[model samples]
Target: MPATPASDDLREGSGARALLRLATPVVASRLGIMAMGLVDTVVVGRYSSAELGYHALAWAVTGVVLTTGLGLLSGVQVMTSQAIGEGREADTGAILRRGLVYAGWIALAAALFLAVTGGPMLHAFGLSAGLADGATPVLQVQAVSLIPIIVADAGLFWLEAHGRAVPGMLAMWAANVVNLIVNLWLVPGGNFLGVDGAVASGWATFASRLFLLVLLAWIILSWRRARELGVLTPAPRAPHAAQAMRRVGYGAAASYFIESLAFSAMAIFAGWISITAVAVWAVVINVAAVVFMVPLGLSVATSVLVGRAYGARDQVGMLQSAGQGFAFTTAVLLAVSVGVWLFPEGIAAAYSRDAVVIAGIASAMILSSLFFVADGLQVVAAQSLRARSDIVAPTATHLFSYVVVMMPLAWWLGVRQGGGVDGLIWAIVIASTLSAVLLWGRFAWLARRPLVPLAQPRAA
Candidate 1:
C-alpha cells in the first residue's frame, strides 16, 4: 500500500500548531481583502457624500447579485480539502477546467443583466439625478470586472482547497497595492476623468487584481505537491466529472441568489429613508465589511478542517474541527466587539467626517457589532457544513433566517417602527441569532459518525 497522505497527518495533528498552520495566514487573507474595500470607500469619499453613495449604490447592487458567485467554490474548496485529506491529490484539474467553463457563463449573464437594468432598478430605491447617473456607469464598468473576479475565484478556492491559504492572501495584497497606486493616479480631484475618474480606478483595480491572481495561480499550480489538483494527466477520466461539476455549480448558484437577495434588500430599503440616510447606511455597511474579516477567515479555515475530517471519515476529528472553529471565532469576535464598542465614533471617522454622517453611522456600528458576533457563529457553522458536503441543511437555515424572518424584522425596526439605522441592526441580529441556532443544531447531528480510513483508488 502507498504511504499515508499528509492530510492524514493533519487529521491526526489536531494540535495548536496544526490549527495555527491553517488559520494565521487565512486570517491575514481575510484582512487583505477588507483593506481593499476600505481603500475603495476612503478613496471615493474624497469626492463628496453623493459620489460615495453613487459607488455605494453600485457596489451594494453587485453584492446582492454578484457575491453569490463565490458560492461556486462551496465544492472546490471544501471537497478539494477533503480529497487532499484522502491523499487523492492527482485528480483536481478536470474540475478546475470545468469550473472555468461554468464561471464564464455566469459572469457574462450577470454583467449584461446589471448593465441593462441598473438605472431602473436603482430608481426603485429612490436614486437621485447625480446618484443615478453616477451609479449606473460605475456599476456597468465594474460589472465587466465581474468576469475576471469569477475566473480568478477558481484560483482562490483552489488555494483554500489545498490548505495553502497564504498564496491567496498574497494575491489579494498584490491586487490591493496595484489598485491603490493606479486609483490614486486615476482619481485625483477634478481630473479629466471627472467622476468617471472613479470608474477608471475601479477598472484598474479589476485588471491589476486579475493579472496578479492569475500569475500566482500559475506559480502555485506548478508545485509538485499541487499535482493532485490536476486530474492525473494520464489517469483515466472519471465518467461523471462533467455531471458533478454541473451539480456543484447549479447548487452554488441557488444558494447565492437566496442569500444575496436577502442581504441586498437591507441596502435597498435603507435607501428609502433619505439620501443622507443611504450614505450613512453605506458607511456603516462598509465598516462592517472591515470588521467581518475575522469570522470570514475562521469560517474558511473551519470549512477546510470539516471537509478534511469528513474525507478521513473521522467522527471525532469533525467535531474537534468545528468546536475549535466556534471557540476561536467567538474569542476573536468578542475582542473585536470591544474595539467596536469603545471606538464607534473613531471607527466611523476613518470612513467619513460629516457630523450627521458620523452620528447616524456610530449608532448603527455599536448595535451592528452584536449582530456580527452572532453572524460570526452562523458563518463558521455554515462553512463547516459546506466542508463536510452537507450543503443543503445550512442553505435551508440561512434561507429561513435571512429571508423568512430577518427581512420583515428589518422593515419593522428601520421603517415601520421609526428606529432608523438601529432598526436595521436589530434585523441583522434577529437573522444571525436564528442562523446560529440552526447551524449548531445541524452540526451536532452530523458529527456522530464512525471513523473509516480513506480508500485509495486503484492505479489506472
Candidate 2:
C-alpha cells in the first residue's frame, strides 16, 4: 500500500513543514542538474573557450527541441498531482497514460529534428562549416537518446504525482554521476580523441538517461502498487487532463521562450562589447542558472502542492501552500543573494582565470543575484497560479515582464544609456522584481477567489 501523510498533516497549519518535506527531493534534483551543467562547462572549458562556445550553443539548440516536449512533464505533474490530491486513483492512471503518450510523441519529434533539420540550421548561424559539420553527427546520435531523456522526465513527474520525489531525485543524480564518469573517460584528453570526446558526452547522456528510465520503471512497478491502487488500467482516456496540462505547458513555455530569448540576445549584447565579453557573459549566465537551481526546485514543489490543492478545490490548503512556498523561496534566495553580492569577484575567479572576464562576470553576478531571487519567486508564483487554471495571468505577466518590460528596458539602459553589459544585467533585475511583485499580487487574488481546472475526473 502507498503511504499517506497523517490526517492532521494536510491541515493549513502544517503546510510549511509538509511543503518543505516535499521540496527536499526537488532541491536535490535541481542540485543534481546544476552539477551536471557545471561539470559539462568545466570539462569542456578545459578543452578551449571556443569549444565551450560551440558546445554551449549546440546544447542550447538541441534543448530548444527536447525541452519544449518536456513541457508535457509539468503538465502531467500538475494534472496528475491534482489527481492524487483528489484521491482519484483511476484519474491518476488515466493522466499517466496520457502523459506517456505525449512523452513518446515528443521523443520522436526530438529524434527527427536533430537528425535532419538541426545541423544546417546551426551552420546558418555563422558556425564554421567544419565545426557545424563536426557537431552534426554528435547531435544526431544524441537526438536518438533525447527521447529517453524525456522518458526520464515523464517518470520523474509520475513519481512527483505520488509525492515520491526521492526516487526521481536519485534517478537524475545518478544520471549526473554517469555523465561525469563518461566525460572523464571519453572526452578528448581523457579518451585521447578531440571532437570524438564531445560526441562521447552526448552518448553518455543518452546512456545515463536510459538507465534511469529503467530504474524509474522498476520503482513504479514496486512502490506504486499502481495496479492495486486502481491507478493502472488496460486503457485510459484523459483528454481533459491533457487539456489542463497544456494550459500550463503553453504558459510556462511562453515564459521560458521569452526568458531564453532575452538571455540569448545578451550574447549579442556582449558581442557589441567584445569577444571576451561574450566569454564573461557566458560564465555569469551559467553560474546564475546553477544558482537558480535552488529556487527552481522550490518553485516546482510549490506548483505540485498548489496544483494538488487546486485539484482538490481546497482553498485553505491552496493558500497555505502558496504562502509558505513563496516565503521559503524568498528566504532561500535572500541567503544566496547575500553571499553572491559579497563575493562576486571570488565566485567569478573560481570559474575562469582571465582578469577582465572575471571582473565582468563578478560585476554581472553581483548585480544579478537579487534579480534571480525575484525571478525565482515570480516563476513559482506564476506556475502555481497557472496550476489554479488562471493561465491568462502568467501569459500576460510573461509578455508584460519580459517582452514589454525587460526587453525594452534592457535596450534603453544597456544600449541607449550605454550601461553596456551591466546595464543589461540591471534590466533583468528590474524585470524580475516586477515579476515577483506582480505574480505575488496575482497569486493572492487568485487564492482568495480560486479558479479550479477541470472537475476531478467525475469521481471515477
Candidate 3:
C-alpha cells in the first residue's frame, strides 16, 4: 500500500516521536544502572543501618570518579552521532576503536588512583574512625569495578550512537539481575568468604560490572555488520579525530568533576555533622538519583538528535530537538516534584527502615525535589549545548554554579548555620537552578548563530 504524507511523517521518525522512541529504552538503561545502587542501598540498609552508612560513604567517593570518567568519554557519543549526520558513518568504527583505548586508560588510571588513595582519602575527610574503617574495604572493592564499568560504557555509548540502545538496555538489566543475585547470596553474612555486608555488596557490584563489560563487548563484536561499520579494520588517519575527541572530553570531564566533586564534598560535610546525617543524606541522594535517570536518558537522546542536526547544518532540526528535550524534561520533573513532595516518607521508607533516618530523608527529600527539577533542566541543557559544539560555556557555568556557588553555600548553610542535610539539599537546589538558567540562555544564544563542526577537513 502507498503511504500517505501523515503516515510517512510518523513512520519516517524524527522529532518528539523519534526522541521518545530513543528515550524509552535509554531511560530503561539509565534506570537499570541506577537500580544497581538502589538495590545495594536496599539490601545493605536492611542488613544493617551502620553498614548502609559505610556503603553510602564509599559510594559518595566512588561516584565522583565514576561520573568524571564517564564524562571524559562523552565525545564518543557526540562524535558518533555527528559522524552519522555528516555521512561519515564508517568513521564511527574508528571512533569506537579509539574510544576503547581511551576507556582502558581512563579505567586503569581511575582504578589505580582509587586503590591507592581511597582509604586515606576517607581518613583525610575526618570521618569517625568507625565509619572510615567500615567504608575502606568497600571503597577498595568498588575501585576494582571501575575498570570493567568504564570500558563497558565505551561500548554502550558507541552502540547507542548508532541507535542500538535496546542491546545496551538489555545488558544493563542483565547486569542488575546478576548484581541482585550476588547481593542476596553475599550480603547475608553466611558466605564462605566471611565478608562484611558492605564489602559483600561491593563484591557483587564488581562481579556485575565485569559481566556488563563482557556482554557489551560481545554484542559489539558480534554485530552482523561489524566490518562494514569499521570495527574490524584499522582507521585511516583523520588528523582531527583524536584531537577533537580529547578536546570535547576535557571540557566535559571538568564539568562533571565540578558537579560530582561538589556533591561528594557535601557527603563529606554530612559526615562532619554526625554519622546519621550522612546516612540520611545517602538515602536522600539515592532516591533523587533514581528519579534522575529519566532526565539523564532524555539528555543523552536529545544530544544525539541535536548532534545529528548540527552535523548536517540543519538549524531547524537542532532547535526542535533541544526544545523538545527541554519540554519533556520539564513535564517529567513537574510530575516527579508532586510525587516527591506529597510522599517523601513513602519514598524514604523504601530505602531505610529506621524512623529517624526516614524522617531525615523525608525532610531532605522535600527540599531536594526542587534540586532535582533544576538538575534535570541543567543536564539536558548542557548536553544540548555540547551537541552544538558549545562546550566551554557549560563547563564555566558548572564551575560557577557548583564550585563557586554551591560549595560555599553548602558549608555555611549545612554546617555553620545548623541546617544539616536539609541545608545541603537547598544549596544544591540553588546551584542547579543557576546552572540551568545560564546554560539554557547560552544554548539559546548559540542556536541563533551557526554551529561549527567539531572537526574540519585538513588542507586538500
Best by lDDT: 3
Q: Poorest 10 consecutive residues of model 3 by lDDT?
A: 2-11
| lDDT of candidate 3 over 343-419, digit per residue (tens) | 98888888788899888988888888787778999999999988878889999999999999999999999999999
lDDT of each: 0.72, 0.72, 0.88
lDDT of 3: 0.88
State in Å the error of residue 70, model 2. Answer: 2.5
Model 2 per-residue lDDT tens digits across residues 1-460 = 2435421333334778778876888888878866766776667655555555555555656656665666646777777666666666455666666677778887887788778887887677564565566556666766887888787777677677567778889878888888888777766654544544456666666777788788777777676467754445744454555676677677666667666666655654554555566567667777788888888788778887787787777888888888888889889889988998998888777766667767887888878876878888888887788677677787688778887888888778876787877888888888888888998998877655645556425432
Q: What is the TM-score of each candidate against the true structure?
A: 0.91, 0.88, 0.95
Which whole-number lDDT from 0 to 100 does residue 35 have in model 3? 96
How would you encode candidate 1's per-residue C-alpha lDDT over 143-214 as one tens digit per residue? 777777777777677666666677777787888888787677666645565544457657766766677657
**Model 3 residue pairs with clashes:** none
Q: What is the lDDT of residue 417 in candidate 1?
A: 87
Question: What's the CA RMSD for each of the models?
Answer: 2.9, 3.3, 3.3
Cα error of candidate 1 at position 159, Å: 1.6
What TM-score quantifies how close candidate 1 is to the native fold?
0.91
